[model samples]
Target: MHFLPHHLADLAALAQMALAFLALCLVGRFVGGRQAQFEIDALAGWGLLAALLTLWGVATTLSLRIPAAAFLAAALVAVIWPGRRPDRAAWGELGRLVVLVLPILAIMATILPSQSDIFMNLMPNAAYLVDHGTFPTAGAPDAHSFLPVAPYNTQLVPFLGSLVIGGFQAGGLALFTICLYLMAALLFARMLVTPIDGADARPETRPGWAATGFGILLVTLLNPGFVPRVAFAGYGEAPVAITLLFAGWLACRAMVAMTAGETGRTSLVQLALVLVALVNVKQQAIGMLIAFALAAILVAGYERQIGWRRAALAFGAAALPAMALYLVWRVFVLTRFPDGELKPLPFDEWNWGNLAPIFVSMGKVVVEKITFFACVAVLFVFLERRLRHRQLDATGKALGLAAATFLLYNGFLVVTYIGHFPGVMSVEAHSFFRYNTHLALLIEFALVVTIRNRLTPWLASCPSLARQAGVAAIVLALLVPVGFAKRLRFDFDQPQPVVRQLALQLAPELKDDDRVALLLPGDTNSVDWMLMSLLHFSAPRRPGLDVKPWDHADQAAFDEAAAEGYGLAFLSCTKGNSLGLPDHASALLRHGADGWEPVKVWPYPPVDPKQRWQPALAPGPLCRS
Candidate 1:
């Protein structure tokens, strides 16, 4: 299969991921035994992969290349190990859907790196790893080298891509994200169809279950929050949310199985690994993890399925891996990145007075946004029946637990946003919808699972109409992205114009030994950081070129760099003023003594002419007298 040079990186990444998937499956089989189902095996495999990556990241941070080498060796061993395959019927059924969905996913992954977050942090972090082969430390020269308290378990895909492609490839990293999304969707579909103990698994029920599972999968795929974030933006929240969903689903399954006196050792182990991976993926996951654990305990207690002692033991077992991984990362952060503390915002003084406005704002968002309101409705619908029916079935318990987790998740967000920004409730209001997209998916899933049985009879009665409706729904779901496509400016076939212009303007003037101080704001979405990444990616062979963020407070560093014969680069918008010039650079520019003159200003495409400015590059030597 002949492939373009650019496509080779993504292809290699996909190949490596396939290898990793196989390895994970083998490891899962080794731990969970041959009796484990595909869902259990898949979750277990992902957990093992997460654990290995966690260890790998720590090792990289410590500058120990041995673990990376050991991981490759382990992957080889996993590939060689013989393992039992999934149930033939189940595999065949799901394989068809996977095949249908894979190409769309591939296309999305290819173009996904254009999402701003990739440029903001994920890409930079991955590029740093590719360039230096280690995590940023306190001693790192650039102030923005490593974000404080940012858990980089999510960056594993990008790191792995860098390893596979022999450089940083955004498309490759995005493919990894897409795989996680697909795996989550696959597991969700399998969970819906797979019967719990005492549930009717007859041929009649199979079709209904299959239809329900397809519905769930379609809804998840069509969700504005799930696929877009997973495929394009490379948000850690998507992976964390989906992993937690799978873990919660498994926990419910295990609880039901345990009640029936059937032990689910593999399920429990898989849950443990996923929870651990969740903690490592993002800090917010810690709260979600606790919520899931609590829901498990409550469900077990409510059902009186198993003894409290046994239930506690199972939950604790599932929590062990996550707890251990947390401790490991905690120690690593303390020793290596002491400044990496989990304090993004200050906790306001205890006050009921502070929460009222926040609650009002949150309520407004939930009601005003169609997507958020629909999700809220779904949660309520699931809760209405499940709460009233005290004599709950396994499905009821699962749905109930999911609802509880969703409620708890929202509560956590409320506390976080209100406590952190007491005065600016509007800020939380803006992000409230975006942040809760995954929670919405969980609610929708719970709603579908809970109501599927009731709708199955109706669906079976009108088979022809049902078939037409299903086809139409799928077609509509597929077409929905067309509306979104207009908003997306990125082209999979072409280089980003900003990147091209930055490279053209800056790369030639930048010498191997030159240190270029970026003149840009300290905002999280600063375009200068993206410029730095583009420069590094384009000129990988150029050594000893340091690109550091310039701030007014860093006057001494700027002065020292200028004194030491370094270069200065200013980023601006083609239609607007420069992002901001540092005080030292302004002084040098005014005097015209340091050869700080206007270089070529590269124009970039603007998302919105009114709000966003087109990227412009201005580079000059800072040290020339």
Candidate 2:
């Protein structure tokens, strides 16, 4: 599953992706320097600082090139600066990461974007920001549904993709998303490897850094709610999940540093940057950061290990950035898109009295997610084992942080349901499993850190075991995405990518004012309007590619279409049509004043990664009726 040197093309793409990432971190390093605490590595130093910088540019200049140019300068400085060079240990860690997870990177480097959110949210919004260069002065055009959702509106992952290859290429987005997860894993693993001062006498004897880190990545995917396809599909959860882990790590480390009498200045900067990332990544993130801070204070102030003054300092450091970012975004959103209508539910639907059922519903969801409970159960088991004696060490502290934050964050979620989302979504708690995923890694990594006391010895004896298991996981991660691409389900949704491919194939001939409509043999109401929406957003300035599904049964429908200038129509792949699309297959279409016309059928083929996901445009219309 590891990347091979012989795969030069993939290697180059991965390298470009990695260098782009390091370039962002380079800027972070230069901006932070001695003011930041990167006790392990500087991966999360700026915590979506690139995205924030890009947002400001979008607000002002409206070009990613501005931030790209800045990062390019950082890249140049990185090329010559002796201070920016990786230390020997860091170099070795880099090599280990390459060998252990190269295949996973390969998967990240190759997959195309097929997720609905890419079409509906990220890509359209990225295009809007780059094109308009400001917060939206108005709402979505009536012809298109490019309504950007709040909080998820931040374009870090998409911005990186655009920076890598023009705009929002799925491959680039995937690589960056995986890289984001990798950064979080490294932070967690580093925290795992390093013991609190004076807690472990033989910290040097610990093993499994890269392997354990890679395992942390696996734990994230192991999440029952984590559909790898969706996570990689340009949604905001994966980023939120990973960045929360990053912020959680930084927050906990700040307290640990406090206990060890490390200088507070750098710690404050580190906490602040991640806090900025956290708040911008999701609306609920401010609450999550508060949970983390409270957990940190509880653990650090245990028996007054750190005086209240220092704890208050750490609290101030975290709160200040979170408040500033939250307010900045709030003001931006309020002043610009005050009528933003893409909310999950309206406040008028709120029912505060529904808390008991919502709580029970949430409990059912939690109980159903055995994976989540196992995560918590491991913490309980480890905490029990470790605290058999009445002593709390760094491992114990992390366990408590995980437990404390888990309870607090879940409480915050209940508030959200009551205040903002109590409606039909409240029945199942609206993607409860998926939302919990944001904190899954923190708990999983905490368990990884705690279990070391039990596993490190056997692992030390069988040093190759961790490496081999991690290698297998790497193999599985690479192989798993292949299975997704092989079918048309959530991971690699049917028709969306293929429809986009068909649109691109037909784009050059499409007139700027023309709207495309799908001529389905029959309507099952499938595609969820996704196929047409994707095609509509496929072009720049939207170019009015307006896509609508054509009803073949009614001549009045055809007349209405002609009234609306529907000149281009394609025979859509439908069940009655046997889902087989022949390349150049002729179909009947009412081409405006031209009356009935025979046109080449639009091809919608199944995605097969084995064939590099080529759309199999065949030779005949397999339409049954």
Candidate 3:
């Protein structure tokens, strides 16, 4: 079967997601509290996938059906469980917002590049999980080296959705990441909008739809530092940002619950699961989880919102599940590959000399966000009197959490840099700003909460202006991610020509046990990894079987393996002067005793033949890596 055209592919992806999200949200709605329903559902959606991936990662299970069946059963239980119904109006509002924004989201997902370590790390792992129904063990074919330890939580969307789609589609993650970003915006808006009623919602007062929308735009579109390309480009940081924001949000609730002399059970499953999902996303996430937890507990203690002993117990209870799950994953990894490459912790390298430069460079990233920090300063002013009186509120707790986490996580980064990246740290802190973006949502949460008192009243007094502002915000929010993301030049499907063309050639020749040598050494504009991925996963099965990248083998070795009946095939998409094959254009060659014989001769990817910007055709440069 042919791969569906790009547009159809996205539709197929969203269809699967729509089902899995419903199942996931049902469990979230039942087990989780009704407050911040969107946040609960969105993060729960992420959490379920994380759980499934963690389970698959830890278990030697041979069937994807185990995770899939568990989800269906839990969702079924959540459905049949007797419970109060959810807020219809709130659900309606969220539904309307999703409808308004989905087209733009779909457009963005379609453009998410099939590049970078996506092919090397994320996609291969995801494709393997979906195709094989299990993650790669110590030695699995078609597995990239990082599969053993690289966090596959980010791969969950595509993996889970592929269960329904019958093959993996990478667009699901971008779509879900955008959706998570939306939920984060809404959650932050709720934090601010509620204050318009002076921190209490009056029974007769209308819901602040306009003000909610207003806050969303401010937190999302107006925040100049939010780069869509980075956030939506299948990075670990985007999901971490959402999970971290949820941590602060739910932690605020826990603070409030403890202050009121009760357990924060309402938010615990979600909060704990959010943490569960967080620590599993990346190794750095465990550091983030600790940092945020410390900030929350410390702030709670300092604010005296609850008795110190009681707060500590409650906070520890909340963190218990996450810590336990993290340990489970650790045990699984250690048992599976005791001497394998898991990238030595705190790194194997140390550089005392780099400390000064790392410190200075990291500080500069903070300074560059002067406006955000300036907002944080104002928040401190707002909380000063309350904290001085030993009577802080959830907003104050959120500020404390974000602030402390900012300090702690970045300081964690310094240690990480000295270890994991000492060489790069000698000059500058690597990806400092990008790493800091994980806290962007929480920072904006504090920013919005600080100003909510004044902004809400101002908006309420002028309903016309608020309504117009909401409309403009909606338009801008939809336009901004697409506009900025396009500027990054990844907004195209034309780049898949090499992959699309190669898959057509290989599917007809290779069998289940056959191996293919991907000798297309790429520089800045073409990629062999992505080509291999497309060949392995783009369709139901003219393609869906595994084809390992045997790049290390040269002509002689390939011929050697061929003589031994390995049926080795070498493919080069580059023009020439590659892999000891001189004066030859791109071709698929079968290694044999008679020397390498051409199985198929093809030019380097020509531009998409269709050319028009229609559903069936892609418009752009021919072979963009």
TM-score order, best first, reads: 3, 1, 2
> What RMSD does each model have against the real structure?
6.2, 6.0, 5.5
Report the lDDT of model 2 for residue 596. 42
- For all candidates in order, the CA lDDT equals 0.57, 0.57, 0.62
- Model 2 C-alpha lDDT versus the unseen true structure: 0.57
Candidate 2: residue pairs that collide: 62-133, 582-618, 582-619, 583-618
Clashes of 1: 0
Taking the tens digit of each residue's C-alpha lDDT, what string does model 2 give over 13-65? 35545766666665566544522222223444345453456357436645555
lDDT of 1 by residue, 415-473 (tens): 67655544554244446776676565565556656666567678779989877866664
**Consecutive 10-residue window with the lowest summed lDDT within model 1:** 616-625
In candidate 1, list every pair of residues with a backbone clash.
Answer: none
lDDT of 2 at 86: 48
